[model samples]
Target: MVIRDFDEFCRDITDIYESTLPNGEGQVASYIPQLARVNPDQFAVSLCTVDGQRLSLGDSKVDFSVQSTCKPINYSLALQLHGEHIVHRHVGREPSGRGFNELTLNHDGRPHNPMINAGAIMCCSLLKREGEVNVADRFDLVMDTWRRLGGGTRVKFNNSVYLSERTTADRNFALGYFMREKQAFPTSTDLLETLEFYFQCCSIEVHAEQMAAVAATLANGGICPISGERVFETKTVQHCLSLMYSCGMYDYSGEFAFTIGLPAKSGVAGALMIVVPNVMGICTWSPRLDKLGNSVRGIEFCRRLVATFNFHYDTL
Candidate 1:
């Protein structure tokens, strides 16, 4: 088994989950009204090892919007559809060192990386409607990918959250226009279609239980642990995880890399997906967010997790 003494490991995880419950700092993300109204006190942690061991605590089964946590999956799909060379042509692989939604591009006139809004929007544009008839077909392809990543678990769409995101998407719209102005997007890219697709991707909903399976797929080198199916090429996962490590935490990327030493992505909806390559995948969800837009209880849970286990990349 990937985690020896699985029963003992689960007990340790339970202890960490209980210890993180009293944290009441931070606020729910209010920019999106639907997200703002979520129960901020709710917290959950779920994990799945590469060998298929599983554990969940608190509100692990409760659904929440995926939000920015969708970036790595979308980027992976784009890489699988088009090779790295083609994908990187429009999006760089370096950290942006700015806000996740900053109106900036690299010196080469590309979005810094696929983890940020600009780069994620660029990735949405690359998922061409080839072979797919309409925008819904394209989104169906994305949903299919998410299902594969989640070990064939049912993934749901949140039309309300999608509408909320679309309604409050002025910044993303601005990003699309700015990229078009810079000639960054592919020729004939439908700016409106791309932005709506981005919002739709963000609004997909899943509970921590499902997201842990998704993370485990990445941890197991793009193979779903439960289904034992290869969902992505190994090289695609390597590239995606590398960027998630360096750029996934918004402005806190550097600090998170330095301290946690694990590849993780945090969404404003208070979802944190973490991968311990060749070992396990973890997902923590709590709607109370820090100023940096990370989940307060989720961050605490991760801190405790690493301190208890030698999961840190730098750990000898």
Candidate 2:
């Protein structure tokens, strides 16, 4: 099953995608009104090799909210801006056994890691903590980074998703205030602004191919293969990959690490972004989700992908 060339790789991807299409085993996320309305049958699979070879299958051009897939990028940005030591001071690099929106923290008064809601909120607060940049400027920075990560493609914010998230973000707000009570946030950090920015990031929209490019950027050690531009420090990507590997797929992180063996992040929007470091990036979208809030087709695809290719880090 070695994919010796781009054509073979593309063929295999399409084959795998088609084979997995009939399982239709999960439900669309109904908590968010916008997400709940998406077609549950819509699916896409995209891959971008380290050398910039790209392939897509199914509804690859359809756009959807990035959801929690934005966590790793936002975490990387905060680490790049403030360094690991300072960032770790606010969020621990550990997995939360609970769900993504749990109002919990580690013993040290920090969110377990940047992949969960609490940690992500802390990461958002840390983004412009120096107060040198306004919230608008900070958001622009995030969007600019996302665009470059997507290989210079345009990625937009879905206002409907943003509004939906804002309306149903009671848990996130509770997490924020909980962290604030624990003094996990920075001294000058504004809770409301940080939470708003976090929701905005989660609302960013991109197709499967674009998200694959973003994952490929991280796979390429923060250098975009297509653009030949450095998007983040190598150390930043390293830190993010580490956290994503350990905590990215909500509470299913441990099992995914054992089976898929890749650094990846999953969003409630049924998006999965995987990084096969030094090899390629893979993105899969299916609006239907398993009970654990992961894309059912996406999880199956990763299993099939590693079984078909030498993608598992251990195998490589």
Candidate 3:
């Protein structure tokens, strides 16, 4: 089961992708009307090695909303700019043990971690927001980061998805206001602008291969393999990946860690970005989701991936 070379790795991944094609056992996310419309049968798997070698199969070039998978990247940016100490003051590193969007906070009034809705919102507030840095500037910075993380590929925002999420995000509003009431955000935080920024990050779109590049960057110690650009600092990537390992899969994080044993982040848009440490980064997309909001086929691919190769951190 060892992947000695690129061809073998491609062959094995193709086999696994095909094997899960017929087993569409979950539903596309319906709460977000835009996501519910994605073709449930569309599936893709893409991988990028530390050396920048790449492979993709089935709809890998098709674009989908990056969704919550952007959390780790956003968190990384926060840590890079604010440092771990300042960032952790607003958001803890522990798992919430509840739904990703559940209105909850730790005993210290901080959001549990940056992977969930509350924490991500807090991370959004931590981003530089002041005079001369308008919403457009904020958008450019985040999208630019996503582009570099995607190995210089263009990553777009789905306006339809953003509008839909913004319109229907009462839960997010509640979470934001709750944290604001608890005085969790910075003194000058603008709640509306922060939530808008958060929605924009969640709505950024990337193809499967593009997301694999982002994951590969993390796996390669924050260096984008395709471009050889240092996108994030080593410690920043470490902190983001650690939280992703513990809390990135919503309520399913614990089980996913136990079984797949990789640092990963999942999006409701049916995407999973997985980091294999010094080995590679993998991305899988299938619109069918389990109750906990993870892509079912994406999880299956991770399980098979670890089984076929020594990709799991614990195993290594």
Relative to the true structure, candidate 2 reaches a TM of: 0.98
RMSD of 3: 1.6
lDDT of each: 0.92, 0.91, 0.90
Model 1 agreement with the true structure over 13-103: per-residue lDDT tens digits: 9999999999999999999789889988999999999999999999999999999999999999999998999999999999988999989
Candidate 1 error regions (>4 Å): 129-133
Q: In model 2, which runs have C-alpha deviations exceeding 4 angstroms?
A: 1-3
Candidate 3, 97-146: lDDT as tens digits? 98999988999988999999999999999888444457787778899999
Ranking by lDDT: 1, 2, 3
**Which 10-residue window in model 1 sums to the lowest lDDT?**
128-137
Q: After superposition, how far is residue 58 of candidate 3 from its true place, in Å?
A: 0.3
Q: Model 2: per-residue lDDT, tens digit, 104-186? A: 88999899999999999999998885757588999999999999999999999999889989999999999998899999998
What is the alpha-carbon lDDT of model 2 when measured against the actual structure? 0.91
- The candidate 3 region of ten consecutive residues with least summed lDDT is 1-10
Q: Which stretches of candidate 3 lie over 4 Å from their true place?
A: 1-3, 129-133
